[model samples]
Target: MAQDAKTLDLIAIGRSSVDLYGQQVGGRLEDMSSFAKYLGGSPTNTAAGGARLGLKTGLLTRVGADHMGRFIREQLEREGVNVAGVLSDPDRLTALVILGIRDRVNFPLIFYRENCADMALQPSDVDETWFAQAGAVLINGTHLSQPNVYETSLKAARAVKAAGGRVAFDIDYRPVLWGLTGKDAGENRFVENQDVTAKLQEVVALCDLIVGTEEEIHILGGTTDTIAALRAIRKGAPDALLVCKRGPDGCVAFPDAIPDTLDEGVSARGFKVEVFNVLGAGDAFMAGFLRGWLRNETVETCCEWGNACGAIVVSRHGCTPAMPTWVELEAFLSERERPFRLREDVELEHIHWASTRDRVYDELTVLAVDHRSQFLDLIAETGGDPERIPHFKTLALRAVRQVAGRDEARFGMLLDGRFGLDALAQAADHDYWIARPIELPKSRPLEFESSADVATELTEWPAGQVVKCLCFYHPDDEIALRERQERQLLRLFDACRKTRHELLLELILPAGMDSDSRTVARAIRRLYSLGIRPDWWKLEPLQDAVAWRETEMAINENDPLCRGVVLLGLSAPEAELLASFEVVAPFPIVKGFAVGRTIFYDVARDWLAGRIDDEAAVAALASKFKVLVDAWRRLRGAAEKAA
Candidate 1:
């Protein structure tokens, strides 16, 4: 029960569910055609939101032993939340909620939680030692509606309190969840019920902090008057900090006496923005408030953090995914003239997109075998069946596996869906960093391979696969040609943003364009000016250190959150590629190489011509790939040593 013994900042206990949000805004749920899935439930969102804000948080709940449960656990882990206590219950199914945004004020939702796994949470599921390590614990009011979950949450709260940790309560009052309304009325936030009021009051009495909106406070205080509700709650838990979330007007906090007016308490004004969905705003506010409160910040600062977080989430779509990261939160707060529409803020959106990505590759040594036309041409030259190209692509993947040995973080494959479908599936199964091509091979002015509807096409690709579009571009191209290419690129960039897929824009100078060191950098700047900020850039290796610096500076100045760059091999010989590596050794922006023809051209040709067996081809390809990797490492090491 020592302060030093507590390691985690917070542990959230209560509901966890998979939310299927109707994609069509301003449409009724019955007429909705498509849905986007996101993690949901009050405590789960709080845990993830807290973790995203740099808190060491944990979740204590039960999920069904199914794919959805695995998704919840994996997502929590991705958010940097400790899931040691997220147990899988084989007896029940995980909870689910189908939600739709009809408009700003009308959000229709249905919760299918009739004997769900989270409600099956038992006292036995609460681990005392694990609960004791947290500095604070948060339990939502929904968990108290059921006896089993109520006992489970109470036991965990007692464990944390016994360890000198604080307990916070979020009065997440849902009348449907408490069975006070029809099963279909999940959108109903409150229903006056004496039993619900008494139950919430019991939980509120055990808290160091209590947070709720006016309706929620009404349910807890058994009164509709805001000041009377505070007086009621203060009488029960006199020392607890009471935070009242007043939607657009921001939030207010009371540390001691119950004030006659809500404005008498410590208050912070919310941002002026259009509300998209008010589903997860309170959970975000709770996470933000904890970020400051756990750090012992002033009450005003806590209110500000909470208000900003709520404001940002209300203007976004889903709950858990809409939670802002610490960097995003700071950026939003640092703005002097805040945008009226937070969703339209380009820099904030970029920060959210970059920071919330599930994976980050510090360095990528990828095998660029995403060539379609080149493979067909090679097959034609060898008089071999084009059918063998897919198998050959599979062999290339095997070669990468042999060299990388499942080290997915450091190694990747740039494969095309046309010939490398099977290989792409296998690579994705092993969680490799994969990129697939969209642009037709060697198309001047760039045309998509399959369909002009790139957004629809991207939906078929796996979420992990980056949309790799190789554009034959030159900054000095004729105005018409340049504009056409830029339009296609802009379309592709917009598609990637919609599909939530990372894009790697590979820029190559068309066959006979005169170029200097500044050409590529200028091309990058032109794209940035057009607002085409791809997550990754694939460029030909620069000729000198000055060129590399220019490229780095261009990217850094335009978008620091750009995922850096990967060097592309344009069928260059191995010696030439190695020399280019030496030139790029000192620059940290060039992550690694995605060389194809140099490593695989000869081996692939020999294999296609039946001059070499599969094993021989794989061995040769792996050896060549390892040689380039080693050369990059050696040169990089030497540069480090010299510095």
Candidate 2:
């Protein structure tokens, strides 16, 4: 709040909530079993998106003194957004939204925000110092509809404008939030009341820029006609730049004068893309426009960036998490042959999430040694103490260090809690990523691991670590098997959600069904149909590029937010595994290889048999691991060039 060169570029004040989106497509909320969580609300999204675009943005709002409140603050900090103005209210609860994707057209949602923390923001909570530091102050229309928060928003806007800061208004009208009953609350766009119009016009006259859709313009201007409403808006905010968002038709901008014809004003063609969810498009457009407006760019360029950002968000899932960065926006704009439809390409999603992720992984080559009892049986012949099995995991950890020392690679190890908990704690500090296995081995019916329950184990692990679970599943037409498998998966999926840990599901086709591309693809789709969106798909190597592409398409089509697939080692020979890399290298979606037995099986066995020393086993495993990593890098380089 103090005077400093580190002042914010934009300060957005209004509603913030936890958006829980149903993963089941075309299903009613009552029947939904899985939901993806993200930071929601118009102003919150704009703050996060602007920060992602390299703007110094801050949010001035209130969240309840609970986990949700902490979540909002932590996410803002992680995205490099300033939260000095975000206060916590212990007297109320944070807002929550449960949204469903019934199709591309119908996204039914319910808001649970009665007496929420953000709505309870009093004038005393207003931080004028924060507003004074920003170049612009953004106000959401929803905030102006309330009495208490409305006064606070008005005070902040007046203070900022008086201090020579720009006041921008985003007409983010939500009928349900306004307690309107004349029409269907969720579908109401324009109510056209004299009192509402007068209140909005008062703020419109004090703003430098106004952004809204046709419906919002109708409400603010108190007219149903688009042209008349825009003219009315111009009369109030004579000098402010006006933006009219026309869904798929693109947006038109009025820098100074209102045009008689739609084509007369500066316009930018909208990026045509298949719409998955339209909830966050408007917020993304605002963030993109502000990026150019704050930099003093041409109206046409601003419109281009706005349209590009809107297109990217609508093609993906949630708002704040899916907003594209400047790098992604530029790359998407440069592509000449890219399809306009939201094809949900795994390769593209992988690149987008990895590039925008908080954790940096230049190149990942993970050594997965989460194998359980069957592995112990392999050492039974030597009459070795089964308790010494953990030493094998420690040997694999040494091998990870060996490869990491040679090249600057981001490595991860999938360790089992059965005997590798200490190994996990030790490996946690070496700049290595860790994924602990969660499923009990060799269970045809499938169950949680014997040692730790889902909740207990997750509570003990480090925050933000990955949890890997292996299941022997096949997509046969048996209803009982499918239902049983789905129930178990849902339980684990929900656990991961509550615990905030990432899930990597290693799916193996049972011994009977054909492991052909189509069969495997169907199995993957079936899992997704049940709303199982894993962070990564650990699969056995396919035969060729065509088959691998088919598998990639299946995973992408099911869940666009999925992180991507990682190759699994089914104990194939080193030569066979190397050949498989040549096939998958063409697909950028296959981020990196996560091989276990192929890299460590023989060396581990020799070490257990007393035939190899610790140093010898580590060197052997490291050498094999490097071969696969190098092969993957070569193929990935070629794929990137082709892309």
Candidate 3:
């Protein structure tokens, strides 16, 4: 079998095309939502995964010289797939598939390819030399269903096998692409007439490796038990690797040797995870196996790595979006005990803004002090779940797990009252965030001139890291009644410039002045004119009367910069104002917004001016989360250092 010129890890020969994916709205499959495009094809996705895992991978397909074809080529190239054998057909258009993600279990793909160039691949496209070169060759059964390319693939596979290069076959069974035979009343009908599922079983015998999903196994299983399937496969090609992908449960691998019993063969479980889109998780797992195979790892190890790769791939929204980077993958494998964390953390707290909840808290713990009616309202109104607690860690844990969990693999975090380089370094390992309240100086609230200096200090903190800023608009300021507070606005801008560095701005406005006050309108126009781009601008234009129409009119009154409005600042009666928004602005306007100076300016500022101890601040956290005039001396110490 040692006849090849040189050894190569893997070579894949198959039909490649761009699959334009769309999502299903509600429960309707045909009634689709807006569509999105990606460079997707069965073998192409597998090759892309292999290349991403640092494997030397290649694709052999005949694609037309068209936009979709070019897109596929670029996508593969970006993934670093060797495209030396990928040929171009000038006459035909590249193949395209309209893919629908109905649910995690169902994907209905509509192929728009008729006599696509990829299926036109002939035996003469290349000598058996290319097949003879690789350590393993992957042949998608799609091309093999076509006569010319089908015969060519079989022959090249034989040659590669004879040359000691292993053959791996992906029975990428597509019904629409197969059933059609010809245009003028030929013995056509791709999927209808042919027993391709059986034909693929024949190739599986010859294949050194056979990879497919459980559905595929069921299609070709032929009423056979797992033992009987192996026996049947062994009848044709006795010594080859047989694998089945089982999504989150990982995959099963049985190398060339099939024992007399199913229990005797290799059987291993997979990594567990919650899934999102899951369309290409199989291909990614294949790439994982191929990479491990290339490294000459043990068969068990190869299967384990495949399981790991598939687990990560399926947990996210898209095929490519959550692909584990190389360094991260290594770290994931290396860091055994630590749980998986998201790239960033968001903080939420049991803030003492709820008057009613405070009463409930007196009788019950924070966790048990449930708003039974509001939770019911949350579910009934917006379809959000109610049983769960409303904290950043709770929400984040549920989101990452894609389910309510007691599982340890998924994680969520809350602040432990820490900061700076060491905390940040430690935070890099944390997956979720806690609403860590940062206070201003009690002696003086933050001013614009001092903002830049604060920003300069943040420059040394971290790069591309997010810091939440907080501030408020004064209700007693002259801007509400007479005219715009020019000096105040200017100071706000200066603070904005400074805090944009290390701080995140939480623009708090008065519950009363949240309306289309001409003063507020003029101020907004001024900010627009001066080109002052704030991270967020809270729109709190509420009217005295609690009508949806009043709230609608207030929100609709055309401000110069419509998109600039970040949060819809509102209070209790203004709560119905959320319903008034015809189109909920890009951001959400939540209730129970409590500020420091606005609420606990006296005690907190006293604490910040070194009037209280850490014990007292801890006590404050129990009572409420308030916007005092400044933060405790704890943060002020850092501020002075930064100064």
Name the top TM-score candidate.
Answer: 1
Model 1 poorest ten-residue lDDT run: 335-344
Per-residue CA lDDT of model 1 for 1-643, tens digit only, reads 7766678999999899999999999989999999888999999999999999999999998999999999999899999999998999999999999999999899999998999999999999999999889999999899999999999989999999999999999999999988899987889988999999999888777899999999999999999999998999999998999999899999999999987899899987678788899999999999999999998899999999999999999999899999999999999999567678888898899899999987777678998898888888888899998998889888898988998886767899999989999898778667678999999877897999998799999988878789999998989999999999999999999999888999999998887889887888999999999999998999997667787999999999999888889999989888999999999988888888888988888888899999999899989999999999888888888987998
Q: What C-alpha lDDT, on a 0 to 100 scale, does residue 216 get in candidate 1?
A: 93
Best by lDDT: 1
CA RMSD, predictions in order? 1.3, 9.7, 22.3
Where model 1 places Cα greater than 4 Å from the true spot, the runs are: 1-5
lDDT of 1 at 185: 87
* True-vs-predicted CA distance for residue 584, candidate 2, Å: 24
The TM-score of candidate 2 is 0.65
- Model 3 TM-score (2 dp): 0.51
lDDT of 2 by residue, 1-643 (tens): 3224427789999889999988777887779997777898899999999988878999989999999998899888888889998899999888888888778887777877888988888888777776788888999999987889899999998878766788899998777777774322453465667777787888888889899998998888888888888899999999999998988777998988787876787898778888888888899999999999887789999999999889888987788888988777776787655666654554455456545656545457899888887578767866666777888788888888877884533778888888887678778657677888888787767788753357656766676578888888888846797788778888887677556677888888888666565777888888887767787888888776666777889987876656778888898887888788878777766888788888877777777788888789878988988888778888778768887
For each candidate in turn, the TM-score is 0.98, 0.65, 0.51
- Higher-ranked by lDDT: 1 or 2: 1
Worst 10 residues of 3 by lDDT: 347-356
